[model samples]
Target: MYELHTDRLTLRGWRDSDLEPWAAMNADPEVRKHLGDLLTREQTDASVARFQAEFEQRGYGWWAVEVRATGEFIGFAGLDRVDDGMPFSGVEIGWRLARTAWGKGYATEAALAVLAYGFDTLELSEILAVTTSTNMRSQAVMRRIGMTRDPADDFEDPEAPEGPLRPNVLFRRACGARV
Candidate 1:
């Protein structure tokens, strides 16, 4: 039942209705361009399951974002524990919206809200965001939300293959930092 609302969106728990669109978004080449290879339906289902479990166990995770006025599920934006073995270990804020939702400022809007939740409600000291070096779109969203990139924090993502997808950049904003 955890929910965070902004002027036009709601970030909340996943629902059975989200599965179809979630799978479609995962299967989209354009949307998956920075995220890696397109995922099979089964793979997408497994990811949704993991997201749901994280929320149940930790009270916060990647939330299913919807257009508040229409109740249309657009994507997800929220916090996640950075897996161990990454150069930087901490909570990271991330988003993946359907291509239709792109260019609408929804990512920045939801991210600002999630950042507030992390710093104010969760009292996290910092939040990080990572994307492949070439993903200018996501990097723009990171900057729009007041995160700064330090070149020294960039690294080869351990989980990605040794190529275009591996060279990743990290952006961060400390709690209470200007936004």
Candidate 2:
């Protein structure tokens, strides 16, 4: 039920209308490039179900992002618990947008809002972000939100198939650190 608002975007709960566009976004090879294989519609729907459940249980999770003016479902952005087998444990920040939404600063705006909520509302001491080494776009957003990376923190992602996505980078932003 948690939601966020920005000048041009709304970070809100998932809706029935979001499924189609969400599936399409997941199917985008460019969007899923750093991420592994493209997701099928069933996989996409299952993921959304999980996201919704997580939000209900924790009061925060991947938010369905929409353009406030046009009401277009662009993608999702929010906080989630780091998966169990990752080298590190803590909340992680992430976002995924349709190609149409790229280069428009939506990720940065939504991410900044997520960080503020994590620090001010949830009172967390830190937040983390992980991405493939080649995911410069996400890395830029991480840096813009004041997350700092230590090369020592990088790891091989167990989830990624043996490929470019395996060598992952970890970035951290302590509470109160802001860009």
Candidate 3:
């Protein structure tokens, strides 16, 4: 298993045991607020399978995030190719955590590690992060990890429902740039 570690967390591959809590995290309304609809167990399990396949095919994908001390599966954080049909295309960094994992600096820590791996290990020229205009939490994480945004880069997400989540913003951090 490929694993990336931080002082307090571990980013690694999926496991059969992750299904239950992963499903519960996706089912949380607050967690789904910026993410859209709650995902069914089947939907989440399929996502896990898809994520695993991404690792097999691409050597990198969303890694299952967990606490180092307690071995708690809190969420996921990793680098991924931009989804097809987006306004721009490049590798992107993302993180999602259970409610219990919120407000603890875990997202920031995991994201910093992801950015380092994307830029240093993978040698990507730049990394981006996209989120709904309303997702201040994720946006804040982007800023904390030294990604920058130009309001001019904001765009409408054609794939999002015709609502709040439809409007998206793009944040970028180029190689050799400092915050």
* TM-score for each model: 0.98, 0.98, 0.98
Candidate 1 C-alpha lDDT tens digits along 1-179? 58999999999999989999999999999999887899999999999999999888997899999999999999999999999999879999999999999999999999999999999989999999999999999999999999999999899999998789999999999987896
lDDT: worst 10-residue window of model 3: 113-122
Per the 3 Å backbone cut-off, how many clashing residue pairs does candidate 1 have?
Answer: 0
- Listed per candidate, the RMSD to the true structure in angstroms reads 0.8, 0.7, 0.8
Clashes of each: 0, 0, 0
Off by over 4 Å in 3: none
What candidate 1 gets wrong by more than 4 Å, as runs, is none
What C-alpha lDDT does candidate 1 achieve relative to the native structure? 0.94
lDDT of 2 by residue, 47-150 (tens): 99999999999988999999999999999999999999999999999999999999999999999999999999999999999999999999999998899999
lDDT scores for all predictions? 0.94, 0.94, 0.94
Q: Candidate 1 at residue 156, lDDT?
A: 95
54, model 2: CA deviation in Å?
0.6
RMSD of 1: 0.8
Q: In model 3, what are the clashing residue pairs, if there are any?
A: none
* Model 2 poorest 10 in a row by lDDT: 170-179
